[model samples]
Target: MATPPKIPGLGAFADHKSGTPRPATPRFVTAAAWFLCLAAVMQFIASVFAIMHSVSPERRAVLEAQHAAMTGNRPSLEALQNIDVITVVLSALVTAGAYALFSIFLVKGRSWARLGAGILVALTFIQLVGVSYPEGFTTLAQVVCGVLAIALCYLPESSKFFATVKSSRS
Candidate 1:
């Protein structure tokens, strides 16, 4: 196949046969990346709120009462609260980290990242259910952003962009 002639002053090249320039990353994909970033930030904030609430005196009292009723104080309240904080921290790191990493790859047009993002959004929504007051609001915001990001990633222009990137790589 003959190579397309390089046009002066233009950094991009046209296809030799079709004479059309390569498609640029679509706005939908860029928007999706932003939404993913927003979700990640919200997830982190929610985790912080959860940690703060869990360690508060009032919350500790409630937890202590619940623990007394449930286990007859087999495990101390401090022990249970420590475990809860650790779990929240680890979960936040994983979820937020995944969102940040996937957003970078999704912007680069990785097909797998798009699918992973969708799965993450669904899982996040399910997990956020029954979350309490302040943290619940943050989780709700995170879920909304996640849903919007996944929706944008699956839009027609974004789909075409991913397909083009996939074909070019192969």
Candidate 2:
């Protein structure tokens, strides 16, 4: 196989076929990418914990109602335990997929990815505003990851890298 030729206007790693002069990816941008990966993993774990070991509260209530109507008693703990696990598992999978999907685009330096990341970060802040952090390191780590991902994306060097990618598009 032929080694790929280096081309004008391309970054060191860019394929010669592209012939686009993408700048070296900025350190801040790389940091942000890694941080996003971390956030995705954390979110997956959190989503699992958010739904573990019990049926959803609403569904559990409905099941208890039915049981009471039929036999004048509530649903058993054992019956409620795994009844909603499948639904919760599916939701957790979706959450994990979204994180992985978005991070792939962000790492590629797609403009839409940057915009989406920005919006997500804004939403995160909005969701958490004035909420006290629970006593856990994960929440703090998540905050740091979110803040860094947003802050780093707009730095001068990162902006230049993004601009170069845009300007050099074929």
Assess each prediction's global lDDT (C-alpha) against the native: 0.83, 0.63
- Give lDDT tens digits, candidate 1, residues 1-170: 99988677342222233334346878999899999999999988988888898799988888888887884437787888998899889999999999998898887778888889989989989977677776588888988998999899888888999888766654
Candidate 1 clashing pairs, residues 3+ apart or interchain? none
Scored by TM-score, the top model is 1
Cα error of candidate 1 at position 135, Å: 3.1
Quote the lDDT for 22 in model 1.
41
TM-scores for every candidate against the unseen true structure: 0.78, 0.63
What's the lDDT for residue 142 in model 1? Answer: 84
Error in Å for residue 143 of model 2:
4.0
Model 2: how far residue 69 lies from native, Å: 9.7
